[model samples]
Target: MPIEKFAPISRAACIGGGVIGGGWVARFLLAGIDVRLFDPHPDAERIVAEVLANAERAYGLLTSAPLPRRGRLSFCASVAEAVEGAQWVQESVPERLDLKRRVLAEIDAAAPAEALIGSSTSGLKPTDLQEGLTHPGRLFVAHPYNPVYLLPLVEIVGGAQTVPATVERAKAVLDAIGMKGVVIAREIEAFVGDRLLEALWREALWLIKDDICDVETLDDVIRYSFGLRWAQMGLFQTYRIAGGEAGMRHFLAQFGPCLQWPWTKLTDVVDLDDTLVEKIGAQSDAQAAGLSIRELERIRDENLVGIVQALKAGQSGEGWGAGKLLKEFEQRLWAQAGHTAPPVDMKAPLELVETRVSPAWIDYNGHMTEHRYLQVFGDATDALLRRIGVDLAYVEGGHSYYTVETHLRHLDEAKLGEGLVCTTQILATDEKRLHVFHRLHAGPERREIATGEHMLLHVDTSAGRATPAAAQVLSALDAIAAAHAGLERPAAAGRAIGHKARLATPA
Candidate 1:
């Protein structure tokens, strides 16, 4: 369904407040849906609040586009109170079948009859979940991953009594909130994604049991190798690329027989005896030595943001999986806030990038470091490129503008937490080249902090040589250049790096 036609779900209820339940609450609230929550556990409020805090931090770093005003959160005392008047409901109760059955039945009875209910069960079959529900058609499995606000994938599985429209409606709602709904056609125990994850997890446990590798080593095997590839190309496509020019058939022919080998303990179960558990626990503790869980989580979130940004940087046209989702989210945010980029100022520099100094960008002197200045300027340049139609689609067609020269003059220090903006001025442009100037200002005072002069050469990447940019791109550049033609040129446009004053004559 198109995003514009998504059901107007203003209120949602979360039936449980464990990790997954809390994550759902975060996702809903961050997307501007008021949420009512119910959990009998005493610590439920604290737990969910922590999750929401983490979600807010991650979402803040994820996109700059404006989001809707935050939705109100209500903690309800009972399941009935939680679901009352709610347009949508989600059940994240314990995985025990009997417990879920009772909880889901309660929600079904109390929630509006037309409200769609989603189960956050990792392995349970939807058919079992809907067994005795009063409104079985509205119950389906809408499983989300950890840090739900950041990850986009959701598995939507429907049971026998579930109406097809239930799945579609659930998908549309999730899509509206920046999630990708992967529909599962048939009811099965441990649906696709989890099943694959379980296989690897089971094998890792077995490896630990056999003393072949420790927990840390197994993690390294993943994060240092296929894990990176999986972020962009999943298992099959990674192999296809590894197959050289011959592709999947050659890959299958070459390695298909290896599947029968006894290299992995995927089919076997390793007993999690006390000795093994203690050993793994010790190893994990060692791996995270000196770092509190929260600190580690912050580090993890920071790394995730950087990696996702990298993926977004190389995206092409329709873009890659996660990167595409990020862009869609930015677009949705803009649409929700009725935001449009301000028109370029012909007589003044066009503000390209505006961001804050993240704590990570600070150095020993309590200010943002030098290299970060260039990084921020690069991001500003990227913004300019996107605005002028030198985007992923244009680059994917084997054309791109490469920075051939850049000169940065650092004027003043930019301290951590200060907001910064980079403004671009067109210096010159031609069919194959672009010359531009950018000025960085520190805010709330808008004091000039730095300036960069850059020259970019249009390139035909496939030919590995300089080439004329497409007519459309050149036209956009020409228009901007013409608009700024009468403006005063920057005094530092052409500069040399040297001592201008008399060289220590008194000495």
Candidate 2:
């Protein structure tokens, strides 16, 4: 291993606070830097806030190491002011060649020569961008994806005048911001992402122009199949795996011929007729009909939160994908919710439950899904099963609770981020059957979240037949329930499920 000291990263500055600029600020600020943003746009504050909100989800997806809370983010009145105390500067000005050239010169004059300057340019060669600057070699392209805060890829391209040490410095900054810095040893037009996307986009556009496929149909093709695989693994690696027992060599040899096939031209070029553009735009708008971008963004973020949160809860030796990033995410959440840190119960349950609800569980009214009522109740039954010695290991030993039926009722909306708690009660039990009930409540305020009742059958996984809880486990559960005797029976069991119907009871 090479020996090198990891430099300290405490602050960063954004020279262009547009979407990319704001995203860069959030990525660094959330990682605990005093970010100074200088955006000429009037909506800079709102843009930054929105970007930060999206970045939070991405941050969680990227790390699990404990990171400092989001540092002080301030709006600087001028480019010079923003660079005052920054250890690094990410310039994301307009894409015009002149604009980048002018900004790079200004940054070189205003910021310290030792401080690394990174440009969020797609494909503008670093030499061209730094040509007129006093310190041209210190600047390099740190190309990032749209949601720079979440996606880990940062294409680091070098220009003729770029210095090796400066490139390394830029990589260090990318590391601090929680990204996988892929170095493009030489400058290339259109960069990596834009080129790859453009390839696909060109083909899609060709299809549209030729009337071979409509916009929605083309989108559906990607979303239904390749999108799922791409989410977990990209094209090359995915193909390598798909090569199967024969391996990539054989697979590629067989499929390589397709590369020469007359696939529609994507890069060659095509005239984007007004009619086709209108058709695609109209289709896109229709797809998002009655959707508010703000609310849609919220839902999108909420989904990201749930997915990353799930990744963080791996069985063992997991979270390398996002465990470290989650550490930074926790800090940001704490800051937003106005809390100190992720709370750990003083006497946390040795074994309890963490139930879940997916995006589909959300209703149009923006609340706890109606069917989710049943799912929550189902989770409660499992918790009770654990209490009675039917843990996962026990279930593996061929005995489990099988829900025979359920009744559900939902009251009030469970907006995104609403904290939830549930309590399980054993209504009745026998060798063949276990009757259980559970109440799902929202936060400490005791708002009615949802309710569900379930009648379950005890079964042996091996025999797949009715069975009984192990003697020891059943005894422990009976003892625990007796210790809290006289605690109100959850109202759902006594009568039906609802917020008002739920009576005061033991949690």
Candidate 3:
């Protein structure tokens, strides 16, 4: 099913607020779904708060697309209270089977009849977890990776008693929240992802025990080699590229015999005695370079943001893999924000974009950098274009407005976390030309901080020449132009830079 068809749930219940549960909370809340959390841990509130903060920071750097308002978070005293009125109930308790079954039973009795129950078990089968539950049909395993808010994949595994509709609903709900849910064919311990990971993990442990490589060296081997290829293309596809003129079939024919090699001892379990444990622990600590867990988490998130953004710009700006999901998610957000042009005031410029200065936008000097200013103006331009019916579909239809010229004047500095608003004025427009001016304001007082004047030319992307826009776009532009015809023109409109030489003052 297409991701855009999915509808976001209104509320969710999170049981057991550990790292995984907190991540689930952050994901739901950021997607604008209210959350009721029940965790007996003394530091549950603090842990969730930190996770949410990190998630928010990563999101700010992840995309320039407008996001929905964050949903409210409430801490409940019991599982029954948390599951009340919740359409989705997630159990992220410990990995023990008995503990998970007990929690699932409590949740099944309290959660709404229509609520879909999910467990964050890494290896336990859904059928085993569903045991002792009143509504086993609605329960399934939704295993997610660490730092769940940033990693988008979720494994959806159904049990023997789980209904088919439950898996479908789980996938749809995950899509609505900007997640990629892959339903397993059948219930199995550790499912797909963990199985793949465990193989490499066992091999790495054996290598360390044999004194072949340290933790940092092993990590470098992955991150600097196949990991990069895997980031954009998975294992099979990477091998396909290795085939050169041929593809996967030829590559497999040439290297398939290597599978019988004795290079890996997958079946041999390593004895993790105290000496081995201490050795691995010391090496791992050295690899960390004394950085705290939170500090390392922030670094990881920033790097992930960069990778995701780079992928989002791939495939000619359409996005690739998880980046493709992000593009669709952003489109949904724009739709929810009401892209249609609203009633024009006829006396003032239209407010098109509202955002805050993200942490990534700051420079070493602690002020928003020069390029970020251009990014904000560009976002404002995109917003204005969308308002006039020039959206993704419009561009895909073969025509778009390209900014031919732009002049920007900066009046003040924009610091991190400061609110920004960009108002656009339709100075003039024709079938093939659009002249607009944008004023950027900062903070609650709405002080003007910058101005951008631009001339955009409508062009047929396929033909590579100027062309008239579609009838719908032209009509929208004409209406807005007529309304603003009587309005005063901006003083900065049509201004050009000029330089004058001055003699130095006499000392």
Candidate 4:
């Protein structure tokens, strides 16, 4: 099926409200899909609210892309009410097969016939859950990792009666919302990820039970060692690299014989007797070192953000793995902004960029740093260029505008979380050059925070020298310059560095 044929989900229903369900709500709402949620727990609202807050904080640190406005959220009285008009329905009630089956049946009866249903069961087979459903074709397992808002992977599993089109549509929706969906070829008790995870978990339990290592030591082993490699490159690829230039075959040959050794007790099950349970619980408490669960979640989220950002900067900024998905998501967001942006008044400066001061942009003085000012101005310049038919495709074709000279005047402070907007005026333009001025304003009052005057040269990047821009770009630039010709020039336009300002006498 062609991916473009599937419309992005506009509304969704979540039929539970614990950790996993709340995470799903966060992901859907952040993607601009309105959500109707149902959960009978007395504190369901509070739980989801706390989770949403954490998700929001993490996303603030995630990317600079312009996210669509958050979708509205409403609590529903029951599963039937929640699924009334939802295009996508997610069931996260619990892991028990009977409970899931009952809920799935309820969702099937009330949800729109065309609505896609996803079960968040960690290990239950989709076949078992869809047994009595009226429309089994649209139901599938979409198991996700913990902290569903942050983790990108969703294991999409289909059952005997599942339709292939359903899987295709699910993948399309997942892509639109910035997620990776891997379709399982065959259903099993536990899907691929958990199967691998269960094996490791079994061994870890045995180790703890036998007193070979404490919980913290075991965690440190993974986080400090192969965990680093696993973040960017999964197990197989990491092993391929470890094969030392000869690749997977050589590595397999060297390590294949070790599989026969009795190094691991794979089949052994640790009895969760009272003594063992208490021992593990005590060690876990000590490992936490008095930090609350929410605190730990935030720390984990911050670390994940840093790692993902690093990977996004990998391969000379093209991105890798999940970072690659993020880069593509940001590109789509930029394209959406361009299309949905309101028509500007050609007679005034163009409001080219609207953004908030991110957490990372602050310095020790609790204001935007010196270099970040340049970055924001550069973004404004890019927005202007994009406005005039200069875009990624144009640059990829070997031409772009390069900033040659810039003069900046700092007027006031831009603190963290402040909403900022940048307006660009084309002071003058020709086939080979563009002279532009940008004013950055902060807060609802639109107080001017900074001014930047820049001189840009059109260039054929391949030739490494100045050149005249294409005809379309020139035409667009001409129109903007003509509109701004009657406006007064900014005072900072011709200022030189180190120009002294008059000081107030004995303030």
**Top model number, lDDT:** 4
- Across residues 319-410, which tens digit of lDDT does each residue of candidate 3 receive? 99878888898888876654544454656788877777765667899888888777888888888788788887788889999999999988
Residue pair clashes in candidate 3: none
Off by over 4 Å in 2: 1-8, 54-67, 306-415, 419-507
Model 4 worst lDDT run, 10 consecutive residues: 498-507
RMSD of each: 6.9, 9.9, 4.4, 4.1
Candidate 1 residue lDDT tens string, 1-507:
343344657899999988788989998998889999999999999988888987877765565555666789999999999999987899999889999999998999889877889999998999998898778998999888876767788999999899988888888888778889999988789899999999988988888888899888899999999999998888999999989899999999999999989888777888889998999999999999789876786677766765666666565555567877777777666444323445667567788677767655677998888988898788777777777787766778899889999999999999855778889988899889889989999978999999999999999999999998888888878888998888789988887575455255665
Model 4 regions lying over 4 Å from their true place: 1-3, 343-373, 388-400, 407-427, 430-432, 438-452, 459-507
Better of 2 and 4 by TM-score: 4
List model 2 lDDT by residue over 186-218, tens digit each. Answer: 687878888888888878888877888777788
lDDT of candidates 1 onward, in order = 0.83, 0.69, 0.88, 0.90
Q: Tell me the TM-score of model 2.
A: 0.66
The pairs that clash in candidate 1 are: none
Pairs of colliding residues, candidate 4? none
Q: Alpha-carbon error at 52 in model 4, in Å?
A: 1.9
Best by TM-score: 4
Q: lDDT of candidate 2 vs native? A: 0.69
Q: What ranking emerges by lDDT with the best candidate at the front?
A: 4, 3, 1, 2
lDDT of 1: 0.83
Write down the TM-score of every candidate.
0.74, 0.66, 0.84, 0.86
Off by over 4 Å in 3: 1-6, 339-351, 354-373, 387-402, 409-434, 439-451, 457-492, 499-507
